[model samples]
Target: MISTWRRRVAARRAAKKKSIEEDDNANMELTIPNHFRCPISLDLMKDPVTLSTGITYDRESIEKWIEAGNVTCPITKKILRSIEPIPNHAIRQIIQDWCVENRSYGVERIPTPRVPISSHEVKEVLTKIEDAIRRNDDESCLDFVSMIKSLSKESDRNKRCVVSNGAGRVLSAAFDALSKRDPIHEHVALHEEILSMLMISLSSPLDEETRTNLSTSESLHYIVRFLRFGSLSSRRNAVLALKVILSCNDQEVVEDLVKREGLLDALMKLIEEPICPTTTKASLLAMYYILKSSQSNPDKQATISKFLEMGLVQNLLEILVDSERSVCEKALGVLDGICSHREGRNKVSENVLTVPLMVKKMLRVSDLATELSVSILWKLGKDEENGEGTVAIEALQVGAFQKLLLLLQVGCSGTTKEKVTDLLKILNVHRQSVECIDSLDFKNLKRPF
Candidate 1:
């Protein structure tokens, strides 16, 4: 008993010693100076590399030190890292300096040249607009609009007119100044005054040049705000503005419309309104451009998701089944473009409400809608190898399988049919799922759908 107890005590001591050694190994420390350049490389000691037996690090450690700025020699008190860190105050000072350098005659550096109308002249338009607005002379406002419209469009007869004659720049500068000038307490007064003028004339039937200028303006916020005016003719003109702006294929315009935060939601509301299908269609095409443009980034993916959630898929599904074949085809093409992304597919799958809503619409609408609905359903119901059993079974029972088979029989052609057919075959392996594809005569269904 004594011998056994002694052996157990010895083993415990040995285990404790081993643990202590490991702890020391894990906590080994190295000294580094606040500022010390590397002797060999002249860089700050990033991962200080020593030779294999000479305390030099391996190549990977050197690379890591380069990246992490953590290079240090184990024995030497040296910091071999060098990075230029900008101070917050210094950054502010630099920006202030830049702003000062760019300013001319009290105006900010807008990078655009002066309009044909000079500083004194902008005041002239403002003075006339102020008087006309105060007197409630709608005709005077309209006449001024016509004059601005004409000057905005004069053909560039001389080189000097090329930049200044563009109405978009002129209007943008005017609005920018107006929006920035008023105090918060006076915003409402300014808002009503501006709205009155904008509604009275800007929305009127515009010549091509005026429309072009309005659409091409850099101030998209103003564009969106004015477009939301109470008059129908004005709203129609806003749509026209979007059409022209979109045609320019200007990335800045596209970014302002789609990728930016506030603009997308506003545009979406415009599209959602039931007042004008033409406007709604134009909004959608603009959205398509946004998705296709280089301006698209991860941030706007959420906006796209919102669009899909806001019954975009359902709306397009309706168009896809329109009596006009061209409309239907175009709608399908758009749907295909949207669903091509994995993220897009996941969004549709998660939107449980969409499946039933789409089905109801497909029942009454065009053949193409029904066919595409089938395709979309199949895509939604697909499961990975380990897909949840209950979810998989529920999808099978929800009449999704039958829709796929019907599509196979009636709608899809050649290669697409074959893909659908193979998918059905995989799904049919389960007995409950097998019944959903009963429309397919098992023996005769060897070829693609």
Candidate 2:
């Protein structure tokens, strides 16, 4: 929304479209106080920043100014040797306070911006974490965790630094330490910190040392413990770590992790738990990996039964009703994976919401998500022209005919086109030209969905 406002301001500036009085009148609709405007853009400062000249500006505008070869302060015209822009938190606080005070007038309080840790500070903390890891100092781990997690929330520059400069190793070591024994009530908070920070620090992928630590069965056993009894944040991070570990694609390790006692149940519980969106995605992705792994194993029937017992089909269908595109894609992918089994397919057939949402997602989300949604449909709609052809009936009722037709008319592959054509044929035969599919125009299909 701020970007839209900024674009309007930029367009007006380039076209010289409005006079001072007109601009002021416009401000009544969305007035940033004059003091809040950046001198460069004449728009409000979202990230108030100051340079060596004691003049403050928005970070983005001043950076562009420097990149364009401006060698001095925009306000003072004083020459600058360096273009360092320090965050003007004091000014930002005033802006936020003003917005809060004016909240009844449709003013949006700007979010507290994430402060970047200096490279010097990052190096210093990395050193301390590594030293503490060597001594197995839980207290030092606690001392550094808040600062480390804050840094991780900063730019990708800091995240890459954290991964490379031994913080990943330290926290993975610390995570392993905390999992060694059952926790006392007094130490549970500290236990939560170690696991949460490790989750964030290793949020991407583990370095070699950390990866090796994760590969151990004993280590995974403890990580699974976080899912059972850990705090919300801690459990969220555990799923994040599990997603990464599975991505390593060590078939044997995947099998081992899947077999960990209570881990699958815990992961299934997370799927049912109505938590933050990210944690939900993490759990979904983790379940995707586990389901995919279980498919390749000989004990696949047992695994599918486990999923059925956990009532994952109903839980996942509920998740799909309201999730982001990525989460929707993962939920569909897991549904596809588990649908191969009779129990899983029966569970899916029992849910009223499943087929409608599958129809809803076709071309409504990204192509990847659409592909997975289509796969789930194929699993349900195939070779069932009888009363059990509920998937076909649901698809027709919920507009899958037009959606699939438009999907093919768009740039779907030969395989997808075949699936959609087959489903359409089944639905058309059942409907006898009187189907109640939603009205849609094939010409109106949006690109890059």
Candidate 3:
């Protein structure tokens, strides 16, 4: 019995020692070898590649460096004879073996990296797509566009490469051709795939030529078609792409775009029944830009009238009642722009919820929201027709009087303070007519105090 007990004690000690050794190994393994890390990122190099300067880096890190217009090596600062980096396969193998050896320490092995698509290759794909588009081969166009979309999704480098290689021109031309030859129902898949590629191309930094190519009236018309009739995914991409394209173009282009039939209705539809928050915000921004661009046009009020006729006032009020801060601010901005015209102000003042909602959002949402709400109220209050203090009466009824006082107390910007003061004077005129609900006892309160 004594011998058996001694043997058991020895076994326990041996097991404990083995665990201690493993703990020590894990601690030591935590310190990665200096040579295994990329010089630029200081992280483990999963796919090491050597520059012409003999300095090695992870493929992604070095590629980004080169793409950023850097012709010199990151570490050595020597001018690169060739920007092309040769794969450091031997170092990658060493790293993989190290990871395997340290598997017990929870080290994960990095898989071999795929070679990035070259500019020449992207150009080749574009050539094929252009050929297919010219031949009116729908199947070939779909296949090649799908291929480009796949490559674009792989990495940002590939996306830049695709765009730099005239992907936008190619895709826009395809859209133009598709619109001319194919009815909307004939090639649904092909149209959607082309839209998908256009969306990807638009995401990259667009050069002047590409922007001009994309912002054409014909292209805008097709995008509007997709925005109205395409699938849910296509609609989302369409609106987002529209926002980018509009932002890049000048006011004349935007003026023409807003005049497109069914454009306003399509945007309002997106706002009313948002597919996603992003699409809703994009729709609002697009409308905002349109209103802004039309300011210098001869028919600015006519444009505002167009929006008011589309029930924009009601939609913006609904958005203000409940939305995130960003969406609320944008909706308020559009409403403010609308109120720049008499028709817009009258439309806004007619809605009972408009004044109340604006007052509620004043101190609650954000400073920008507060500013826009105040601006809209000031426009309504100061209107010659509403100058009879009707707007002030409505505002005072909805507690705008107290909110304006609070805004003054808290302090505000010079411009905001001016608006607030003017609003205070306006609301003050009707303050006497406003009944104090808190002070009145319903049973004892008399009518028309």
lDDT (Cα, tens digit) per residue for candidate 2, span 23-43: 766567756788899998998
Q: Candidate 1's residue-wise lDDT over 1-449, tens digit each?
A: 99999999999999999999878755665332323234444433322334322334323334344445454543464654422111223323343454456343232422222223333443466456556645655456446645544443442221122233333343333344444433523333333333333322343344455444444434354456545543554455455455556656666667666644555565556655634666665555556666656324555566567666666666665554442544444455446456655566665556555455334333334555555554554555454424643334544555545655656565555755765675566556654533432233233333343
Between 1 and 3, whose TM-score is larger?
3
Query: In terms of TM-score, how similar is model 2 to the real structure?
Result: 0.68
Best candidate per TM-score, number?
A: 3
Error of 1 at 295 (Å): 10
Report lDDT (CA) for all predictions.
Answer: 0.48, 0.76, 0.82
Alpha-carbon RMSD of each model: 26.0, 11.8, 6.2
In candidate 1, where is summed lDDT lowest over 10 consecutive residues? Answer: 82-91
Candidate 1: where are CA atoms >4 Å away? Answer: 1-219, 228-233, 247-252, 259-261, 271-273, 292-299, 305-344, 357-364, 367-375, 382-386, 389-419, 430-449
TM-score of 1: 0.41
